[model samples]
Target: MQKINVLGALLVLGLMVQCKGDKKSVNKVESNAPITEVTESVVDTTPIIIEKPENIKVPDGMVWIPGGEFIQGAVPQDKMAMDHEKPAHKVKVDGFFMDVTEVTNAQFAKFVKETGYVTVAERAIDWEEMKTQVPEGTPKPHDSILQPGSLTFKKTKTSVPNLYDFSQWWNWTIGANWKQPNGPGSTIKGKDNEPVVQVAYEDALAYCEWAGRRLPTEAEWERAARGNKSESIYFWGDDDSILSQKANTWEGEFPVTNNKADGYEQRAKVKSYPPNDFGLYDMAGNVWEWTSDWYNTNYYNELGAVNGPVVNPQGASTPYNPNMPYAKEKVMRGGSFLCNASYCASYRISSRMASSLDSSLEHLGFRTVATVDMLTAN
Candidate 1:
């Protein structure tokens, strides 16, 4: 109920205070090969060959992205460009399959029912683990504050809090999860088709594993979101003045008011808006999706230019948030219903966001990708 303090030393501790969240790492798999010393003549020359993985049939309710070269990142001098989206670079991605829409509530429910999986929000907080995150002597938050729950967006009236203070509108409500998106006493009974909200990165990964898929990388997501128009600022076209039901972004004052011009104040059913050129739906708004790559504010600068595009470029190997060095955050794309031109205009295709891996909020969710191996059935 109180506005979250942006300058607090325990800011990372309040990461779940949002319609958005972030992490400090993406947990890359590391291979440790044993070192073996060989005699001068022990090594014989042998041909080493690598084979391209075979592509498999596209899954149901998904679309194929016939990958090719595309300009990645925001164009130079973009009016809405953020510092992180600068130094647009060329990236080449291989063809892959992407979900036609975000994972729906019904779809997630099926996964939970079949696998008996529990989301991060459904689990109780570990004070022991959390204690290490705070200053040594910081008092433990109340038991009720530590109860199992997710962050939910609560509308504000009259004046808005400091623009940077997200806790003004984002409440860490106990008992909020995928099943009950708005916290206790809320339900998704009649909203089977709506994109599932309040899912953390791990929960999304679990569903991806059960569905035999994986989360898309940052490049893959940006490539898909851009569709056929590489130069357009938005997924629909160049014009940012008119949204026109193409996405489900906030229509009026952000956090405080929504005109509902898009016909929904909060989340809308997947496919309720128009699909991008690749037959993909909701690439711009509705929910900020998770990506596999780690985030770095200066990642684009790291990718120096080359004659050819950087092939299938994954993001930075390790997450580096100068703000929260300890929290593991991943790349988030496509903004959410809370985005508004008057305030948060993160709906731009090139706009970037990061969130803690454990964040589960009402405006955050994800879709999956079918890698060549997963699609090929191994």
Candidate 2:
């Protein structure tokens, strides 16, 4: 069955990345250097002390993630883990500072007010790039339809014919930028602390640049997500019963009804739930956050083969998905409000999702991290 690919850019051309325009700027950097192998050293069984380097003031609202070796992908207890998150491997990342929560609308608004910046969803479609994602000779869309828009989730009243038909629940909402999350008439006036949504990868990059931060590599993100408890399916451990009380996620039937059993029908304010072991809120839910890694299903298969632990590993050089072979996809970690066991049970710590680099959706947002060297250099 042919599906309309409005939310996601359709049939991308030859994985041809680095498209032009503000709505579609991507830097697909590759590291040709060999993977640095972790070597055995004298074990310091003493509890590692967490302290910021002298003279380095910690960024406001960020916390230090003490770096250490941890399993990077799926742990054996994660029954919900998918193929992309499999073949759990050990990895070591350097200490870095991470935002305490998913970036909030108020925080993003501050960036916009200071820089007068416009997000990608607030810009009109670039047909030249759009055409590349669509089939050859596909007629250009009407000018009226080319206005700026993003995918906004509109819950279905009844069960969808099938879960694959995403159009059953998502609307192509013009004017649905981060400010108007549910499109026009839906303002963020009173919801400043909710996560800013409808932001594309480029939009997040712009924010990161303004903040003197960058999206964390997928490895770093996982490390933070695991926090001090690195071996469990969740930061809390293997039990799923307490999930509803611990995180903001879909608590009832998906795409139809949300029980709001967690007292939140949608995204709760930042810090609405308890923080993880690392003091990071919304690590398992609230929203799916953008990471610097390119999406590749077999990435773990490659990493799991390496000897010892992979040290401060960067992501795959290019995006790959046998299903959507051409879309320039990036990794989105953590689940969102709409994730559930009935469908997208990605709330597991090791869960992952992927989206086209050029696509923006209401449930998609990002947080950023800064390394010590980055702060000293800047």
Least well predicted 10-residue stretch by lDDT in candidate 2: 21-30
Cα RMSD to native, each candidate?
7.8, 7.4
Q: What is the lDDT of residue 354 in candidate 2?
A: 84
The pairs that clash in candidate 2 are: 10-133
Model 2 alpha-carbon miss at residue 356, Å: 1.3
lDDT of 2 by residue, 1-378 (tens): 111223433322122222333211121212342232322211224433245687888899999998788888778766666666778887877789999999999999999999998777776677777766655786876777677777788888887656655556777777788888888998899999899888888889989999999999988999899987778887778888999877889988788899898888877898988888889999988889999988866566667777777777777765766445446778999888888887767778888778877778888899999998899897
Best by lDDT: 2
The per-residue C-alpha lDDT of model 1 at residue 127 equals: 74
TM for every model, in the order presented, reads: 0.85, 0.87
Cα lDDT of candidate 2 equals 0.77
Q: Rate the local accuracy (lDDT) of all candidates.
A: 0.75, 0.77
